[model samples]
Target: MEDKKKFLADLRAIWRGIIGDEGGHCPCCDRWGKIYPRSLNETMARSLVWLAHHSANGDWVDVPKRAPRWLVRSNQLPTLRWWGLVERLDTEDTTKKHSGLWRATKRGLLFAQNRLQVPKKVYTYNAEVERFSDELIAIEDCVGSFDYSAVMESNT
Candidate 1:
């Protein structure tokens, strides 16, 4: 029983690390969105279960939020009850007089990073990627226009 309890607790913590409770616009896609930490927790649970069965030797698993219904349904595994706990841990106003959106703080991000033991791969472009892309475009321009038909003929 003790072992079972510990496992559940560890699972829950892992979940929290992935789907952070804080809400923010997805920095990557720039789609305005919100994710409750509980939702993040749910994602982690599903991902870990998948990883356990599919590839034992792999060090990382990629979990994408593919279904909207999964998030909307509160009764799903990990439960809204856990979300309530997340709210308590991260929220400032119990009454929610402020905004309902809960932004992830630096502390929250660090906690998730440390607990999950996985690097957070943000999709948003950093300055370096942007600079490199710009340079590539300039190089392409300098090469002058290439005939598309010529290239296609060479392939044949």
Candidate 2:
């Protein structure tokens, strides 16, 4: 009975992001979910840095406020989320705010601030199965600070 209760509690925590049911490499091939440390591209790097600057105070940022339409349509947010750099606001209060809102994860802020170094590459996996996708690579020049001015300049 105690074990069952613990299991149920853990299951509930998954959706809350308190415990992860996703993430971790395959036990057979040992390649899925493998993380590599490659540099980020200018656009991706700038996006992360910019997000970090805005969300450093743990505030959620409006995604579409100044983002280019093309960028919004891109996989930037998903990619960042996959890399654990950013997260979508998922709380009861989320419905009160704009749907397109996000915030940087602690690791994201650290990486954007040049305080943390993460893998540059990672493999996609689906339900313990490795997906047929290209390995991720970091941008060539993403090791420095990217401020508001730089983000705006890139948009122009």
Candidate 3:
């Protein structure tokens, strides 16, 4: 039980570091235009599902690998690989632009098949306002996306 709890906690921490609390948020938007969700939004989930369906039958899959435009444009799907859900196949050439095959890992398969349950959205916690909410906070709650460089080692 303790180990499972620890794993989930560590998951959140790693994702937070890899992504970030204010992922692509407009710091200048003073009016609190919208506090984006801290979980996998519909757009991202759809994209992942698309990948899963195309790569059915456990076959190695190739895809047009590019940082998704909507994710960048909407600031939603930046740090996807950090979740351990999807991975890039290693090609011999290292110095090349992103354009190749990527596959979903076991965890990603679980997610795609709905075996793993993660949160949908988490509310804002403004430290400046000294406020918090404790409804059903889960590991999937995240703000923004980043890369492996942002990964934080879990203190296990």
| lDDT for each candidate structure | 0.30, 0.58, 0.47
The candidate with the higher lDDT, 1 or 2, is 2
Q: Which candidate wins on lDDT?
A: 2
lDDT of 2 by residue, 1-156 (tens): 999999877754553232133445444465444322233455666677767666777888887886656556664765666567889876576556436678778887766655566666544434332222354433323544334454333333
Q: In model 3, what is the error at residue 152, expressed in angstroms?
A: 34
Give one digit per residue, the lDDT tens place, for model 1 in 15-133: 44443444344434655433321123335333222322222232222222332344324323223222111121234767854332222223322222222222122122221111111
- Stretches of candidate 3 off by over 4 Å are 1-38, 65-78, 119-156
Worst 10 residues of 3 by lDDT: 147-156
Q: Which ranges of candidate 2 are over 4 A from the true structure?
A: 1-40, 68-70, 73-75, 91-98, 127-156
Q: Which stretches of candidate 1 lie over 4 Å from their true place?
A: 1-69, 75-99, 115-156
Model 3 Cα shift for residue 83 (angstroms)? 1.5
- lDDT order of candidates, top first: 2, 3, 1
Q: Write the per-residue lDDT of candidate 3 for residues 12-120, one digit (tens) a residue.
A: 5654453344443333353332333455555666555545554544555555444355533553223345455666666777697653676566665556555465444
